[model samples]
Target: MATAIGMVELTSIARGIETCDYMVKAAQVDLLRSSTVCPGKYMIIVGGETGDVRAAMAEGIKRGGELVVDTLMLPNVHEQLIPAISMTNQVDVRGAVGVLEFYSIASAIIAADVAAKAANITLIEVRTGYAIGGKGFVTLTGDVGAVRAAVEAARKDAELLVETTVIPRPDKKLFDALL
Candidate 1:
């Protein structure tokens, strides 16, 4: 079965929590993370089989009402995405580096997945709306060509892309902070 990931971002923390509760009860999805983010937004991330994830997201969106800020359902998420989002992946930064910034946590996550799958790159980190005042960023490293390709792919159709940059030879100290 193809694993999937679903996310719901809401303006109200209480409503987001309630929606998450209802969503979990409506499907066989596992709640990955549910908490308030910077600037007082709420986000819920869930994972499971594609059908289950879709069902859960449908319930969340229905209950979210006007509180919904964004919703995402990736039926075949990149294998590196979940680990990177959870900050559990250890990446050896090499070659060029790419960075993508977004206004929302959900958008950054989606862009990271797209970039990781677009080229041969290592996801350095996926920082969501924690201390960045509801903004998020993703970092990746690979050869210059690969990194550029990945960044380009991430930029396509991404309305939330605040900034995108590719550093051919990033400072070693930079990796110390990011990875």
Candidate 2:
């Protein structure tokens, strides 16, 4: 149910937490996540109406100041994006599977949104830098052609890309570890 979402990555954990508090107080928004990632990076994600998210983002960036590393705001976010990030989207591992990995969380989230909008696909997961050494990755499944197209579209927008691949037919056992 997220219409607009904003994210801020900071170099300081304390600044990031303080920014999150002020951001929520600045606007009516949902605090999707606010925690330290790998390598001592801190992240904050908020979602709500466009205006509200915008205000919250402004406050967060201002508070983050020199500690800010990266930020992104999606005004018309894809419907599948939130579910994927929350690990709530359900779908079988059908057809081809595409994967996108990035060095930044914002790039991975952006790739997920772009992929969802570019083709008919089911998002498997939109994983952020939690315990993965400050890396982000996205997974989706669809027909081979659609998966390929979606991956290409997402790649063009991805920043700090680490790797990308598409499997025409992934062994089902591989999904066990991914899930």
Q: Give me the overall lDDT of model 1.
A: 0.88
Quick one: RMSD of model 1? Answer: 1.7
Pairs with backbone N, CA or C atoms under 3 Å apart (clashes), candidate 1: none
lDDT of 1 at 70: 85
Candidate 1 Cα errors over 4 Å, as ranges: none
* C-alpha root-mean-square deviation, candidate 2: 1.8
Model 1, 5: alpha-carbon shift in Å? 1.2
**In model 1, how many backbone clashes occur?**
0
Give the clashing pairs for model 2. Answer: none
lDDT of 1 by residue, 28-89 (tens): 98888888888888989898999999999999999999999888888888888887777777
Once model 1 is optimally superposed onto the true structure by TM-score, how far is the C-alpha of residue 177 displaced, in angstroms?
0.7
Cα-based lDDT at residue 153, candidate 2:
97
